[model samples]
Target: MSVNRATMQGAFDLCELFQMGGVPSIIAGGAARDIYFGVRPKDIDVIICGISMETASEILAGAGIASTPFHIYNGAASDRLVGGFKLVGTDIDVCLYDCTDVSEAIDAFDFNLNQFVISGIHHGIDGAHVRFVGEIHWSTLAAVRKDFTPARHDKMQAKWLDLSWRRATGEAVEVPVGGLDGPY
Candidate 1:
C-alpha cells in the first residue's frame, strides 16, 4: 500500500520544521514505526532532545499548531500537533531532556534506532508507512515503562476494546496488529 498523500506530506512538513532548526528529533509513537511498514498513524508524536521549553513552545506556536500540554510544563521542552491524521491520530510530542539527563539515560544501555523493526498494517492509505524512530534512552524508557508505556500499550489495547464495542453494536470488523512491538 502507498502512504496517503496528505498524511505523508504532513510528516515531511514536520521533518522540515526540525531540519531547518537542526534539531535532533525522533518520530515517536505508532506513526514512526508505522512508516516503515506502510501504515499511517492517527496522530504523530515526536521527541526532540536538548531543546529549551521556551524554544520548543515558540516553534510549535509559531507554526500555529496546537498540542496537548500534558507533556509540556512538566519539565519537558514541549509537545505539538504538527498536523491532523484521519486514521491513526498523528501528533508530535517533544521531550527536551537536559544534556546531563540525556547522558545519564544513554549510559544505562547500548540503545539505538537499529533495535526496532518496521511492520505493516492495514490502516488509512494502503501501503502507508510511518517512522517508528527507535529506542535510545534506556533510563527514560525504563522509567516510562512503569507508567507511560502502559498508556502507550493501551493504544493497541483500545483497538480490541473498540472491536468488541463494535461487535456488541452488531458491526463486524477485524482488529489490526499494533505493530512489530505489539503496541507497547
Candidate 2:
C-alpha cells in the first residue's frame, strides 16, 4: 500500500521538530521499515538527543500545538502526546547524549529490520534539510521464512505471544516453511 500523504508529512513534521530544536533526530523502528515496503506505519518512532518534556512542550507550544505529558517509559527524556500531529499512538524517545548515540539506539532494536533510521536532521546544516540514513539489510528484504526474532529484547521472547493473540482473534500467522530457526 502507498503511504498516505498526510501521514508522510506528519512523520516529517514530528521528526523535524527535534531538528529545529538543535537536537539531531532520526525516525526509527517499524515506521522506518514499513516506509520501504510502501505501507502506512502503525506508529511513528522518533529517537532524538536529550530533550525534556518541558522543552518539547515549549517547542510545540510555540507552533500553537498542544501536548500532554504521558510517562509511558521510565527514565525516558520525554513521553508525550503531541497535538496537531496526525499519527496514531506516536512515540518519541529522547536518549541523553551522554548515555546513548543514535547508532547505539538502532542496534538495541529487537529485529534486524527495525535496526534502521531515517535521519532528516543533518548536523551543521543551516535549513531543515533531511535525508534517509543507514542501509537496508538483505535480511529485511527477504521474507520471514527463517527464524523469528524477538519483538522485544527485554522480554527475550519472539512474536509468539502476539501471534497467538492474533490467532485467538482469527488472524493466525502461517509459516511459509516447514521449519524456522527460533520458536514461532
Candidate 3:
C-alpha cells in the first residue's frame, strides 16, 4: 500500500497550525500506525503536550478549528477526551496530556503500534518542508510486517485479528475494543 497523500497533507498542515500557535503536538496512535504501513489513516490523533484542555481549546479555536469534547464511556467511569476537530476531510482528535514532551505522551500508549508518532514539523517560506520525524518502534514494524500483534492486553487480541484480516483482504474493518482511547 502507498501513503495517502491527502491524509498526510492534513496531518502536516495540522502540525504546522499547532506550531504556529506555539503549542507542540504530534500525530500518533492508529493514524501513525496506518501511516507507517503506507495506508491512509482512518483519522488523525493529535497529542497536545503540557497543556490544559482549556488552553488547548483556546489555541484550536483561535486557529478557526471548532472542536467538540469527546468522551469514552466505560461502565460507570467516563473518560473525558480532549477535543475532536475536522480538517481537510480528515477527523483530527486531540488529547491533552500533562507532559513536557511528545515522547512522554507517546509512552502512555498501550501498544507499540500506537506508540509511533510524527513530530519535528518544520515549515518554510521557500516550501522546503520536513514533516516526517520520530522513530518507529521495532515491535510496531514487526507486528505490521509479520501480521501479528504483540501480546499486551487480552482485549486488544481481536483488534490484531481484524488488522490481519484487513491487511490480507484490503478491506476496512471496524472492531470495537471497548472504547479503547489512545494514551488517555
Candidate 4:
C-alpha cells in the first residue's frame, strides 16, 4: 500500500503546528501503521511527552483548531485521554504522556504494529520535512503486508496475549517463531 497524500498532508500540518508551538510530538499508534502500509488512516494519533494538557490546547487553539477533551478507557481506569481536534476533515487525537522521551512513549503502546512513530517535523526555507522515528522490524512489515494479526500486550497482566481474538474473528494471525522483540 501507498500513503494517501491528503492524509499525510493533514498529519504534517498538525505536526508543523505543534512544532511551532515548541511542543515535541510524534504521530504514533494506528495512524503510523496505516501510513506505513500506504493506507489512508481514518484518524491521526499524536503523542506529546512532558507537556501539560492546557499547553497543548493553547497551541491548537492558537492555530485556529478547536479541541475537545477526549478520553480512552481501558476498563481499568476512566478518562485516559487528553484532547482531540479535527483538521481538514481528519480527526487528530492528542495524547499527553508522562514519558520524558519519544522512545519511552513508543514503548507504552499496546501493540507492536502501533508502536512505530512518525516524528521530526521541520519546516525550512525550502520546504517541510518529516520521517519515521525508528527502525521497524522486518516481521512487522511482513505481517502488515500479509494482513496477519499479531498478539497484543495485555497491559494489566504484563504479558503478551495469544491470538485468540484474531482466531475468534476469523482473521489470519501469525506469531513468528521465538516471538518478536519489537514491531515487525
RMSD of each: 11.0, 12.1, 10.4, 10.7
Cα-based TM-score, every candidate: 0.43, 0.51, 0.59, 0.57
Compared with the true structure, all predictions reach lDDT values of 0.40, 0.42, 0.51, 0.50
Clashing pairs in 4: 2-38, 3-38, 139-184, 140-184
Regions of candidate 4 where Cα sits further than 4 Å from its true position: 1-4, 72-89, 123-184
Clashes of 3: 0
Q: Highest lDDT among the candidates is held by which one?
A: 3
Clashing pairs in 2: none
**Candidate 1 Cα errors over 4 Å, as ranges:** 1-3, 66-68, 72-184
TM-score of 1: 0.43
Q: Order the candidates by lDDT, highest first.
A: 3, 4, 2, 1
Task: Give the C-alpha miss distance for residue 37 in model 4, angstroms.
Answer: 2.4
lDDT of 1 by residue, 123-176 (tens): 323433333223442112222222234564555455434333323442222223
Predicted candidate 1, C-alpha RMSD: 11.0
lDDT score for candidate 2 against the true structure: 0.42
CA lDDT for candidate 3: 0.51
Best by TM-score: 3
Of 2 and 3, the candidate ranking higher by TM-score: 3
